[model samples]
Target: MAHDSRTPSVPPVRTQKLRAAVSSRLWPIPVFAVAAAVALGVVLPALDQAYDERFPEVLQVYLFSGGASAARSVLEAISGSLITVTSLTFSLTVVTLQLASSQFSPRLLRTFTSDRFVHWTLALFLGTFSYSLTVLRSVRSGTDGGTEFVPDIAVTVAFLLAIASVIGLVLFLAHLTREIRVETMMRNVHTETAATIERVLARKPSPDTDAAAAAGSLSGPEALAAPDGQPVEAATSGFLTLIDEPGLAAVARDAGAVVRINACMGDSVIAGVPFATVWAGAGRFTAAELEDLSRRIGGTVTVGFERTNDQDPAFGFRQLADVGARALSPGTNDPTTAVHVIGHLSSLLCDLVERDLGDRTVQDSDGSVRAVLAGPGFGHFLSTAVSQIRHYGMQDVQVALRLLALFEEVSWCDRSGAQRHVLQAGLAELREGIGQHHYTSAEKQTLMERYQRAQAAVTAQRGRPIY
Candidate 1:
């Protein structure tokens, strides 16, 4: 059977991070608020003037006789309520974040921080406050008994926004409360990971394509050691999150070089470390050429402080695994939650088992290998998703049983020999760990039965005894 190996359809890590950074910034919301405020500031006066010209009598009646004084009272009240609601929103948000951090993984804080709903909600209230204050300053009383001026429509809109803010506050509180629940958190993470998997590993190659890829794979290593090749060092330090294979290939094709990336996604690298090795055929590159090549290569990969799920499936697995591990910790001691996480992890693994997990090799139009990127294999993801949970939750019978069941479930999938071997080895380790532990006779029997069932499934699949 052809190896089911394909690249994930994720954006380059740097691009993903850049998009995230731009979206996560507070300035976007404020910019929106300021723009809205400015538009209203300019338009409201014109609207008031239109109202005055259209219905002078109605406008006169609407404008408060006390003019600026009456408008100030109304504006002050609206601003005060807004300020109060803003403070309450901030307090509630902080409390929710603290709860999420303490109860769940701190990494999840990014989810809440980058939440567009929360940002827009805060912007709504703050925007109204700014609008009210701006219009309030425009309120003017008649001097020497001239006509009083009050932006009645603007004040009315501000009041309407305050009312909306109150309703938003209610909705925000409900959403925040729902968001903190373990079920909600787990579901969100699972959905994101599943989407990442679908986007990254969705493609299933045809038999001909697979055969061609297998043929191309053989030619990759031979192209690595070209004459006048030099190692290129990383310019920055962070976790390597993405490798833009096509872009790298294009650069390599233009430079007439074969580039081999030394680092894999989700790996931490140091500055001045060998990031990639380039083999330029026949000629040596000048200092400027090397510098430009390095810059282009650097653009192809993204290194960040924390691993993101955009292009790294392993990072998602790691997040879910961490959640399960934390739940299993003595202080938390929540096996049920851990079990829930394990079920999702198992589902992710099953999906992964059917998909391709292989290094991405990009070639030029001339069929020359230009860039080779290392990606996580099924073994790495399988281990990442379960190993920590197995180690931490080894003592729990339920957790152990679930882990065994996971292995059995994956064994039933149309997996490769390597995948089956990994599953079989996991089962053996589980059995050994169970035997070494001090389980009750009943618990041991229960685990042994599950382990045997898993072993039998693997044995039947492999046509030999796994034990």
Candidate 2:
């Protein structure tokens, strides 16, 4: 295979997974904090010994004035108290996680876990405890064997760290309260999802500039493509959380074959299932070539136990939608929260309306199409956001009216009509749905008027881009 400096010969590092892991998991950041604190614990004691007599009188008073035994007592107290506080912090965190999981969507567990504030709070408490413990080892009494010595500066640092940990614990409680709110969760999801959209899609091509969407998405035979191509089976079963397309394309470009991924990002795949297929555009692949190609392709693919917001914008949609769905569930019956989710969904959809979306095609430096991967288009996103809510919330007039309003809100951003048509289809579904519900004549009439306004706007009004 021909390789160039511009092309990656191997799969790129899974930086996205690493990033997701560090953000959502509890240990990664705290481990660094503990290491730094432990080092500081060692270095500060040495400095205290070197500067014991050189310190100015004013500086000396500010440092620890306690004797060696007193210093040991203070250190022990700080360590013991901090370890207790750290345990309380974890308990609070676990309770928050449990409440969020049960009250909202289980998917929202990631939003809470990914909070840097909470992670830093845990880091601070743990760091203070570890620092105190490290410093305590340097505390010695004259009665024991050596001259009484107190690492004043090190004890002072541990004191400062304990104070910081106290503040962190207080702030973490406030932050947790805010995070558990539906509005905050939606905003976080919106911000993260918008960033994902920006990375995956630049801007919507003008109607004349890009008619690729005019044909809509791959359908029927095209959806199931790969006529004479060899199937590339998945190595494991899980959600397709991340894909390294450029690397896959680099491999495909080198092989002179085209790679077509069968599963979209976030789609669940079973092991041994054909998640992709490869067809030679130039020459037939030998059996040896096929085996080697599969190995190369597998490395660029990542399936996981759960979906992540790594490169998959749809994961964000799923989170927001899950929230709305849970809110509308009969057990919860929180129509107001469902309405808020609708607003968030509208924000995301409108923002995405300006971007080119559909099946993403990846090419090499030469502009040769090397990989064709299935993915969510605007329709998928719109449907993902609205469908479940409409199903669950149509009976609630507030949710229905808000959904109607969402169509009109999105109409302003539906400049290309790609999204409005989905909005239009959704409107039709909404109309049929509302008819089945038993509302007052006045309520139904109000709903129809709102629906008609949304319908006309969606059907006839070409939106101006709010970019």
Candidate 3:
């Protein structure tokens, strides 16, 4: 593809991923373990030398009397206790992963694995064990009738660490038990989804005459006809997780070209397919230059096998929706869990209704449109949150009733005209599904009454009948 001289100087997606991976919980255990071992190795020896060579004749009386044997005994005890605690921690983590996978969506395992508490707890236990063992080797026993060197300070510090490890173990147990609950999971997902929305939508440009004019010009025929531009094929096959907008805009602005994104976030793209098309503007570049630009553009877009919550709000919605669907499945048949999920979805939808969504158009400092990227619309999120549960739980009267109540509550919230229409359409679909399915007359009437209340709520908000 032709390189856009205008593309900004944004770091590639891989670089960003690398930075995040380095800071993840996966590294803390090993990093802390090494630090603890090295610190004790150096500090303990220095302290021993200081006490032996310098004064402190009064302190020598308080030093351990059993010589090397006492130091060895303390070291053995600390190692044994830490090993057991570490084993217990691993066992609990594995059990929790299994339960979260079976009870909720398997995707939630990532959240558990990345938990900082789990990482720090394991790090402390292993770190303490390593420190004690290193110090154990330094304990020296003098010959018979000679002075006995005990490394008293090292043993004292090791004992304190052992005490801390025990406290950590107790806290880990309490935390693990609470982390596996459904309410906690729902709340965490909700918070993440909200944060993603705020982060992504905060960049949206306010309406401006110049920006609108630029948007219009970019959509014109001449701009669309990029005979000079080349097709930039995807390097790998995976879901497009994130796109660096500012970087792409800078590239386009610098290259004096326009870039159009073909794949939206959360979309799975195949290798060798055109993920984006770049058209060279007034400047002309050679094939080699174009290739380099293609590589740079590819770097800005990330493709991964699985969808992540980092940039895709839809994934969060999918997770919450999946929980509700699974609960309503025949094997589980837990409507109460599904109902709780619906309440969460209602709150999320309410927040989204007040926000603007669509193609994210990035403008240059001069108010010219440089890049346009695709994002999920409000309707897309609504369908993702409601469609699956509506289909799977249609036969159950309680599920249907609660679904309608969700719609009613959301409709009552202050929302734009378009958002209200989406809610009305959801209500209509539910009423149609209930009508098509076999329901007792009383059951059907009960559902219809709830649907009417939802419809009334919207109509009252709009000052006219929505249906």
User: Worst 10-residue stretch by lDDT in candidate 1?
Assistant: 1-10
lDDT of 3 at 56: 74
Candidates in order, TM-scores: namely: 0.88, 0.91, 0.85
lDDT of 3: 0.76
Can you write out model 2's per-residue Cα lDDT over 25-141, one digit (the tens) per residue?
Answer: 998888898998899889988888888899999888889898887899889999999999989989988998998899888988888888999888988988888989998988888
For each candidate, what is the lDDT? 0.77, 0.81, 0.76
Clash total of candidate 1 = 2
Q: In candidate 3, what are the lDDT values of residues 1-467, reduced to their tens digit?
A: 21112222334566657644654445666576758776875688678777665647776565544568878898889988898888889889989989989988887776777777888888888888888878887777776676666777778778888989999999999998899998888888888788777755543234584365555546423454556656778989999988877778777777776677878788899988888877776655578877777777887788888887667778888989998998988999988888899999989877776565666566666556667677678789989999999999889888898888887777766443557777778778888898889989999889888888778876665423355
After superposition on all CA atoms, how large is the RMSD of candidate 3? Answer: 4.6
Q: Rank the candidates by TM-score, best first.
A: 2, 1, 3
lDDT ranking, high to low: 2, 1, 3
Question: RMSDs, each prediction?
Answer: 4.2, 4.5, 4.6
Residue-wise C-alpha lDDT for candidate 1, range 1-467, written one tens digit per residue: 11124654566546776777856564578568867976796688668756755757755665444466877898899888887988898898888889888887887776677777788888888888888878887777777587777777777777777788889889898898888898888888888788878877745577788897778666543546555577788989999866666777878877877787877677888898887888775577788888889888887777888777677677778878888989998999999999999888888887887776766677665455677776777888888888889888989999998998788777766344447777777777778788778889999889888888888876665323354
Predicted structure 1, TM vs. truth? 0.88
